[model samples]
Target chain A: MKKTLFEKIWERHIVDTLPDGTTQLYIDRLYCHEVTSPQAFAGLRERGLKPFRPGRITCVPDHNVPTLNQDKPIEDPVSRKQVDTLEKNATDFGLAYYGLQHPRNGIVHVVGPENGLTLPGMTIVCGDSHTSTHGALGAIAFGIGTSEVEMTLATQCIMQRKPRTMRITLDGQLRAGVTAKDIALYIIARMTTGGATGYFVEYAGEAIRQATMEERLTICNLSIEMGARGGMIAPDAVTFEYLKGRAFAPRGAEWEKARVAWQNLYSDEGAVFDKEVHFCAEDIDPMVTYGTNPGMGIGIREAIPSLDSIDEAGRISFLKALDYMGFRPGEPMLGKPVDYVFLGSCTNGRIEDFRAFASIVKGRRKASGLTAWLVPGSRQVEQQIRAEGIDAILTEAGFALRQPGCSACLAMNDDKVPAGRYAVSTSNRNFEGRQGPGARTILAGPLVAAAAAVTGKITDPRTL
Target chain B: MRNTFTILTSTCVPLPLENVDTDQIIPARFLKATTREGFGDNLFRDWRYDESGHPRPGFVLNQPTYKGDILVAGKNFGSGSSREHAAWAITGYGFRAVVSSFFADIFKNNSMNNGLLPVVVSPEFLSELFASIEADAGTQLTIDLPAQTLTNQATGRSEHFDINAYKKDCLVNGLDDIDYLLANKEKIERYESLVTSYKLQVTSK
Candidate 1:
């Protein structure tokens, strides 16, 4: 039988099938961070369960670490304890941990790809929801819970019922100034966030084929937002090229063999999928989220949707979101003033995202009181941005590029939004209290954030 | 240790909206409480009440005749942030199972491990189930853990569902990750002693 990539990998990982029909599938890699891991480690301790495969589990303290200062203990005790706990758990379990002070330390999602620990033909589980970020490398990666964390720690396996497959083909050449982030936001807008429920989305077609590994990661990162088990892109020459000298990837002779196998990772032509969504890149704009939910988005030039314009069910939520955002219905999102402009998080904190922001902000001064913040997703991205002169461009533009961490994305560390402040972020989520208490977030692309930083208003980056 | 699976076929209440998020399930403001207790009262707290905190007469849960132990929500029923507080509030509110056409990756995993059954059914089957449930609030449904079947007693519709082999083992056997480890205690101790001895010998050499 011609099986999907998922079926092939899942069958390969199946250790045993329980009587209840769930497969006890073996996990190849387990990535964890501080926020959800302490409890899992405690569960392991409670049961006297040692790490089943300690070597494959990599720990990083990203969620709770302060992005501004990396030299000292975090000021918040709760955040500090979470960070310290992950360190102790990793040490106690004899697992590799890139602690807050470690040179390689960064967000679990970013570090996995940067270090090549995420690769083709692997099953990766992380406590963080953005674990789908690894799917860009052609791995089957998804988030796991603390108890599932305990299960992976004790047995190096997870129980998973199968999910239907979706093949989303977005063909055609992308427009200038449009980005992978825009494509992602556009898809989220069209899909209405739940369009691909109960399915693993396989992204294909020419646009995805041409995207950089970083860009592909951005696409896969938001699959969860659209109700997927996860989203994945098949491995190709670009993937091989990106992983060529990475830290954990196969090298030399092994690389050739791996490449040969990866070449065949694409979905077979004429293969059927449970559902298919087709998108043309020409119509996609540099997208931005105006409301709390990512799906409640409009094109950068479009006006905010109001209760009067929407259906009955959406009216309540739409008006509620508009009220919370202090945005008037039918008003244009462009030229709306911003309190902060954040260019980071796993979504847009990569080197390419930085390059995009710098490309726009070059030779321009940042808008005063905008509090422009740029956080790279990983130490490598931070270094890469500096080497590429992007950091200088940003600082000259009045945006100070901060250290790599999940900074203001969630108010875990010191980077928080003051009450009633509005922020334009490149992160995946815009949930209430995601940035801080009463801090409204509008999710957008790096270019949009750069434009927001320069204008202190939501302007179309293409125009800028 | 409550291994006797009291399989109740839940009277499904359809929350047909897509992208029902964590905030909608349990409002974020209620997260200030240090413990998971008292969250049940606030499950879908915003939707359950009017602007003045009075019960919304139209809300399904507050209806005079609706009584259910299961909730059947639309796709992305648990999308958004990974707050285990959603699960706490849900389970505390007496929902033993949440059947959905789809669930968020984090929220589904969180639900299953927190001892709440997160069941997935075909979208077509779900639409039919929703129709039946909406017809009668006194609808009694039985979810048989052993057979992996859902039976609507009122409608005489018996539907089969699929669960993961390992999660089914855990949920049905009442064995969590820690319990699974304890069950393998003998093999674990044997492996530990062997590893310890090998380490000591290498150091001595």
Candidate 2:
């Protein structure tokens, strides 16, 4: 039988079928972080059990660590405790840990791929929704709850009912100014936040094939936003080239052998998906979200949809979202004053993302009243920013690069937008108060965020 | 872990707003806690409270007219982030079940594993639930887990839902993922050995 790319990787990871009809899936790699893993580690201690394969696990403290002043101890007692617990747990379990100030420390999703821990035809598990970010390398990765985290730690496996498969194909060439983030936002708008529930999605077609690995990572990072179990792309030459010299990647003869195996990781030509959708890359715009949910998005030049255009069942929530955003029906989102602009997160905190942001902000002065944060996804990305002179351009434009952490993408850190402020963010989510109490997040791509940073409001990059 | 989840019949608190994501359920700032306890206090903390930290009179849970063990929320409940704190909050707040027209996949799984029943009903039925509860503060719904049915006692309406057969068994037995896997340890070890030998053979080739 012809197999889809998801199926090919999934079947390889199956250990056995449980009597209850769930598959016992073997996990190749497990990534842990400060926020979610403490409880799982506690669970392990309570049971008097140790990790089945300690070397297969890697721990990092990202969610609770401060983006600034990493040399000092965390001042927030609660955040301090979480980070301390992870450090102790990692040491106790004999797992590799990259805590704050470690040379390789970064967001779990970013560091995994940067260090070449993520690989093709592997099954990765992390206690994070953005673990799908690793699927860019053709790995079958997804988030797990604390209990499932404990399951993976104890047995190196998880019990899961296989999900149906869906394929989203993006064909044709992207227009200038459009980005992987824009394509992702466009798809989420068309699919709604719950569109692809109960399935694993495989991204294919010309545009995806053409996307850089970082771009592919951005696309896969948002898979959970649309309610998919996960998303993946087949490994190709681009993938191999990216992984070739990474710290943890295979070398020499092992690399050659791995390449041979990864070359066969694509879906067979005749394989059929349970559901399939196609979009022209030209149809996507430099996208932005206007409402509370990521799904409520439109092109930069477009107006928010009128309430009359929405169904009765959805109209009430639609109105509520607009009320929360302080946006009127049928109003153009362009030129709306933005108080803050954020450029970091697993979604768009990569080196390419920084380059894109720097490209737009090159010679322009930042808007007088705007506060923009430029955070890198990893230390490697931060180093690249400095090495490539993007940091100088940013500093010249009045935006300083903050330390690497999941800052402003979430409110766990000190870098939070104040109440009732509108922030143009490149983060994946724009949910109510996700950045802070009463802060309204407007989700956009790197270019759009850069435009907002310099213009002090939502502006069409095309107009800029 | 608490076991044996057979049936639950209780009143419900309704949150009519749609897309009530996990972040809203429990804000990211509150996620700094290492343990799962005390999250119930912050369940819907921002929505339930004003900036000054006083309970908002307008929020559903704050209203004295409604009180219940079940939380009937709007569609796509528990979307965003796999914090598991959302499930922790619902269960921590003593909600035996959460009913919605749809649930984000990870949230649903987390709820099921954490001793909280996630009941998925038809959109029309979900609407009926909101209306029925609103009309009468005394509204009670019964969720029969083994039977896979959710019934509205006020309206005498009932709907059958689907659950994985294995999950159904676990729920009834009060078994979590860890419990089940531990019970089947030998099976796991055997499978691991098989996988090890298989990998070795492939690498040798």
Using DockQ as the measure, which candidate wins?
2
DockQ of candidate 1 relative to the true structure? 0.20
Q: What lDDT does candidate 2 reach at residue A110?
A: 93
Q: Per-model i-RMS in Å?
A: 7.1, 5.1
> Can you give the lDDT of residue A67 in candidate 2?
82
Task: Write model 1 residue lDDT over A345-386, tens digit each, in one string.
Answer: 988888889888888899999988878778888888888887
**What's the CA error at residue A151 for candidate 2, in Å?**
0.9
Candidate 1 local Cα displacement, residue B122, angstroms = 10
Lowest-scoring 10 consecutive residues by lDDT in candidate 2 chain B?
Answer: B196-205
DockQ, every prediction: 0.20, 0.48
- Residue B115 lDDT in candidate 2: 81
